[model samples]
Target: MTLHAHLTRTVARPLPITSVVIDDAFWSPRIEQGRTTTLPTQEHQLRTGGQFEALSLSWKPGDDNEPHIFWESDIAKWIEAASYSLAKRPDAELDASVDEAITLLAGAQQPDGYLNVYFTVVRPGERFTDLRDGHELYCAGHLMEAAAAHHGATGKTSLLTIARQYADLLIEQFAPGGPLEGGYDGHQEIELGLMRLAEATGDGRYRALARKMLEDRGTEPFYFEAEEQRRGTPGYFGFLFPDRAKLAERFREYNQSHAPVREQRDAVGHSVRAMYMYSAMADLAPQLDDDSMQAALAELWSSTTERKMYLTGGIGADPSIEGFAGDFDLPLHGAYAETCAAIGLVFWARRMAANTGEGRYIDVLERALFNGVLAGASAEGTHYFYGNPMLSRGDMTRNAWFGVACCPPNFARLVQSLETYAYAQTDDSAVINLYVSGAATFDFDGHALGLSVQSNYPWSGQVDVTVNTAPTVEKEIALRVPGWAQDVALRVAGEDHQVQVHEGYVRVRRTWRAGDVITLTFAIVPRITRARPEVDAAAGRVALERGPLVYCLEGVDNAGDVAQLSIGDGAALRDEWDDDLQAVRVSVDGTRHLNTSSSLYSSAKDSVEDATITAVPYYQWGNRGKSTMEIWIREDESASF
Candidate 1:
């Protein structure tokens, strides 16, 4: 496809963040932090963690490798973050550091094109022997993703060459009829990463490669079962893996291959892996036009989102497997919504949007963004939360860092790469997927289409879009009217314009000219949301939400534990901008219900006392000192949340 055609492809594609400039109060500072603070800090962590040192030593052949099992992928994620940071705003030192790592990786590549520091330096003779538990393909997937990011941002092929070589090696081992037969990644990441590689290089074979991998899993004589049998039971296995029975059991529900991807309906196994595999399926659905794959994705998405998802748009209620347990079996304090799961949810949601071009997908994306992903990182952008919970009584808090530091880099990379998800362009139209103060310019049939947007967004409901295109370029611009918004007001150049609202977007079509403007206002008001009665954890409770954000009550703000609070039937909610939280805080008239018996199990009903309190955005909680936080408040009525 020519540049013009590709730029205006009807199918949804992310505009290069480089082409679009984002300078909003909401996102610019976060991106800057990723560039200046987060990237540098993560790079330092990777170096101190001996990720680069391990790869460099693996290349030395005789040296011992002293890094963790998944260090390569951790470093790869940091590299991915650095690549996005560099693209958004270049950093000389960070670029040099990434170059140095890439050079080390280039040297570490085996003559056979294999690249893994753990297998090479630690278990040289046993490469590809532990696909059930090993993360070799997972690391390769992260490297491919990093290479794609580096190539897209810097227009350099050095890293891409390394990734291609590694990919070829993976194909040689795992591809159909390859020497190493029936091999698949224990982790489901490589499939999605392969899709990214295909998009980066425009080689459909990578997509084919991804499809082959997904189709191969959960087949007769499952690779995971065979691997487990080959390794034998606990006492019979090798000393390196002292617990084979436990490891063997992990291959079942923990890896998400208990059944074929298409046959699986409910989300199972690792939350991150489930989302990754499903996202790859969704990404491949439109590309291959596969009906089964599409149906599988739709059913899986509905299964996860409808009954299993949290009010905060989180999944994986069970911590034992770090994944889903059963439908509507959500636990409040024991919620195990990992940061990686939320990131994978964002990935899935975006691909789903691109596949269908529907606002519902973006709605899920925004929920994960404003609540889960945003909550992963701290207000300073340095600390991270690996697990996000809906109701915490001071036990959960963001850590400075982690031994397995996936969330920090993942959060950093996502925040730095926000340009793509903000807006998208079609062949003869464009979609405003997100509301932010920024500008996006793309070519539409030999015409330069520029969209300049200004809005306070989640802070306020008003959004103003200005068009800078030739009058001859007739096109449509669809503004997303959030599902939460009703009676949306629209205007064109100061004149009230009547437009039909469909699905979730307000469509306006006309010949565009320079300085043409469109304004949209969504009514921003606080709403009380309740969960289904089946959610026992949230029975007779409610959550507060304003705009796209979900609000929670923290103990510090209310001067008491949130468990003591209850919302009246006709509560009057008020909004005020809290400088500390950096968001508009909502206060509600409520009651503090307490049992006077002082017994563990009291037969008497709790006494209700008048108490007014404020609630902050769920993402803003824990920013202050450690305190109890609760999402679901006791309802005066019988509404569950």
Candidate 2:
């Protein structure tokens, strides 16, 4: 019995970049900025950061610069981002740079198809000896992903060839009956990368290898512990982690290897790694027809989104381990919502949507995309936020680059690949997952169907879609009804249409038409929302949400400090536009608790004064210089003075 013997999964297929064109008021400019500004800045950073130079295997131990074990992965991500940009709009200079990078990687690959700059140049002849600490397989995974993206964009096989060779080597070294059987990378990403390679090359070997690695994980005797004993040292990161016992005590679920994955219930460990692992599991569950894996995925999805996730769709509360803490332990002032983790959530959410054909996953995807993921990078697409805190005290700001620059490139890739997330299709139906203004062409049994969507989503819920199809094609066009919206109305050609809503989508079945117009409306309005009582940090506090954007009060916008502002019950809220931001802002009536008495332990009550609070979208915070910011506002118990 083998995992690969099961039937292949049937998931929704996304339209290719060639078949979809995104021309809209909101996403068009951002997509262009991703290609023009973000990609160039990342390339320059890679050159200066020694990522491109390290591929020559020239750095020494005592040199001014040392090659990092994870440097290759950074460059690999940039390559992937650039490849996506090139696919949409070809640029000669960008193509040349990609070619140069491929040349460097090709030169560095060993005869055995193994690739890693640190192990090759910094410590030769000691490869694959530190699976617990070293990131060799992780880097290989990124390379494989970059290779698939490059091949898909340019139809070039140079990087694909190198990726296949390295993948072959990995199968030999890590597969069952291999010398190093039962081995798994400490950081998960290769699983997703292997799945990408399998799709691109039509090779089942890569997918099987991913399954084998996943199945080998969390097995007894724990390969990492045994590998540490063999090395006779704590590990590379021994100083911070000390020993396995101390590491286990401090970080309860280290890398999510505490138990067999199918038996695991909670979402724990490194936030980014956990998301990657769960994403791969969601992808493989249907293909293998494993009901247990799907159930496990559902449990984890609830544990993550229902309890651990932030209002802005951010995850990972504790900064100490860059992972999740106890349920409902979300602290607004000190949050570790890494940018990569948000992107990982988007990936997993999309896969879950494909697995179940449900609209709830898409809701999470939209939340993360609009708030958490967009907040990671600045509007200009150059500066980035490594950790997005729910509350900022004039100290949190964007940086041009970081020592570990993983978030920038990861953000770039997701922004450039936005079109694929907007729409999906099957043999007899076309699904609109996101309300982005774009045009997508789908072919069903040699008949073509074209759909053009127009709207300013996350701002207005009025989506106007025009469908064009061949005379022979008569299929269903499904539009997703957002979970947050209310009083949804749908009309076909100016006539109110009554349709059955199933699984959060309104499915319309009709004969072929050339210019059939459909109007879907959901009144977008400002509302105040509160977290569960269990979330102690947000007790008696409410957050503002308009459409999909979460609004936050910044000191620059309201008074000089937002820490004392409290929203009274039945506060009047209105939407206004900020000239500087070119986006809608929220205005509300509140009270500010004034500091009166000077005595430290005085029992005197602080005087309250009426105040008008101005709030901007959470994603746009920190862009207008650092200032005090808070998402959850204190609630005033009394409505009348």
Task: Report per-prediction Cα RMSD to one decimal.
Answer: 3.7, 1.6
lDDT of 2 by residue, 488-592 (tens): 999987789885678879988788587889899998889999999999999999999998899999998886889999988888789976678878999988889
Give TM per candidate.
Answer: 0.94, 0.97
Q: Which tens-of-lDDT digit does each residue in 187-211 have in candidate 1?
A: 7888877878878988666667777
TM-score of candidate 1 on Cα atoms, chains taken together: 0.94
User: What residue pairs are clashing in model 1?
Assistant: 531-641
- Give the C-alpha miss distance for residue 166 in model 1, angstroms: 0.6
Clashes of each: 1, 0
Which whole-number lDDT from 0 to 100 does residue 267 have in model 2? 91
Q: Which regions of candidate 1 deviate over 4 angstroms?
A: 1-10, 58-65, 231-250, 638-641
